[model samples]
Target: MTGNESRVAIVTGGSRGIGRAVAERLAADGQSVVIVYAGNEAEAGKAVAAIEAAGGNAAAVRADVADETAVRAAFDLAEQRYGGVDVVVNAAGVMPLAPIAELDLDELDRVHRTNIRGTFVVDQQAARRIRPGGAIINFSTSVTRLNLPTYAAYAASKAAVEAISPILAKELRGRDITVNAVAPGPTATALFLDGKDEATVERMSKMNPMERLGRPEDIAEVVSSLAGPARWINGQTIYVNGGAA
Candidate 1:
């Protein structure tokens, strides 16, 4: 895309992992990027600095995606800094796993608040503020389909995201916008690897047909395509799960 034709993108949870990768890819693709992190100021700063070093315009903003005021402020900052937002990637999520019998309700609430409610806050802002022909990309996980033993709560939350995506797409029909979700399989991220032993991680990696866990950049590639000139793709959940589900 030409520099003038490039749009501005806001990537939530963008300090690290999949979010970071998506932010970098968007910046590289010529879209001015705003990277939103919850608490990691250092990591956020590093992301912004890297983008600048690579000749891409970027800024880091701190916000809890689950907070309406924070989410709105993030959008406002993007608008003030870059005129308007054309793309939003909702990559902020939490994935604590436990069997249903042992699941902690408090932890469940936290996950739901961030993954489901957080998605709504960001998506609502994008719906209201995004330019015509802009795109809204939400994150889901292949675990929703895999139905792993300990993923009950997490899957339920993501299932809610999947449920809302098509409706939002239809809601934005007249405005020439697209709303979609990307469901990734086993990916190598702190969130995915945390608490898992090497054997567990290796087993998860082998679950994919590709015989390896996904890289953040792999998911970023999908986000890049959806945010670009491919306006024809709308109201769909595209799986970037390496055929895992």
Candidate 2:
């Protein structure tokens, strides 16, 4: 593909929320997109339909990000159909909040399995198969810095993501690929809003100087820059938190 024209992207968790927004934005920027969702075929269909309705090319694939085989298949599909993938956004994550003392061991394992292992699995495939000049954007949370209560397990998992992303960037030195993490704070998505009371949501909104929660489109803008022309920005965890941390 010349420039953004006809380039391709693979966006995990693209069926909804930030992933969906990123997929739509990349497609709008002229890249074909593969929306890799865990389940929720209906949501995946909606994302693809929205992209196609906007005159962009997109498809949906159901795969567990933590599953190496499934992730590889997702990559294979992107390569086989679009020639190659130019961007891989590892946005599939699960957050079950609880204080460290009360957190279930099983839940901690589940969180790590999806957030940490999933990031590694998707990043591995991206490192292996993505075309040069590609970008790998992983998701993290500002809680690692905010040190919020009831976020120990989730924060710990994302901290691992932050640690590894930069190392991967260095390891891919000769290749023209960028590895980075987007750590958003208090974004307004089902992932973040679910189970949160109105008062709790308001409290988070006021924590940021912006006095408002981030939109999915807000995060998408950053990803768009990284995936396309922001090659100088590598091995960094950008805190897209409106100065919350």
Candidate 3:
């Protein structure tokens, strides 16, 4: 937190869910936030407005993190707007569930491209451009550890991310930057609840020690802490999953 008040942060998939919450929280903590969304201009705009109304600085940028060119441009936008980028939260991802034998190869490929490749693209940019003392926070899911049925493909994608992050941290050793991942449990986001029955949802919630679904804000708090004064936390996959794993 020793940086200028105008420090810039780029949050992918910032239009909704945990990404939106992270963007708003970072803005509230005095960073100029760049909200990156894939296909929802309106949701992104609303996120910006919410930050602005809360007396925090933010702007919405349209980009698919899985696309290298788009992600490069998003980083460029942040640097141009605030002089330098200080933090990057790779919250953009997809979760399509199916048993191994029943899983569509197309669906598996899509998840891998977005979750695994997208994380690499963003981390590469952050490594090269982010200021010293900056943070690179990636997203993973608790399902990696939970080993839930129908989560094989999705979990595999995140498991790749979990494996890569620590190496990135070591690679950036001299830079004083921290690279980490946050693995959230079953959260009550639109994506997580979609197609699930009430009984199923409640049962999933009960799996956690907290005995309830996670809120987007709950995950945001972890991101905010890592991105700010808590610089000592590096190369760790912090599970903010209510001990569900």
TM-score of each: 0.97, 0.98, 0.97
Q: After superposition, how far is residue 211 of candidate 2 from its true place, in Å?
A: 0.2
lDDT of 1 at 122: 93
| lDDT tens digits by residue: candidate 2, 1-110 | 56545889999999999999999999999999999999999999999999999999998999999999999999889988888998999889999999888999999999
lDDT of each: 0.92, 0.94, 0.92
Q: Is candidate 1 or candidate 3 better by lDDT?
A: 1
Question: What TM-score does prediction 3 earn?
Answer: 0.97
lDDT for each residue of candidate 3 in 1-245, tens digit (9 for 90 to 100): 35345778999989999999999999989999999899999999999999999999898888878788888899888888877899999999999988999999999999989999999998988988999879999999999899999999989999999998999999998999999999999998987998889999999999987899999999999999999888889999999889888
Q: So what's the TM-score on candidate 2?
A: 0.98
Report the C-alpha lDDT of model 1 over 13-37, residue by residue, as the tens digit: 9989999999999999999999999
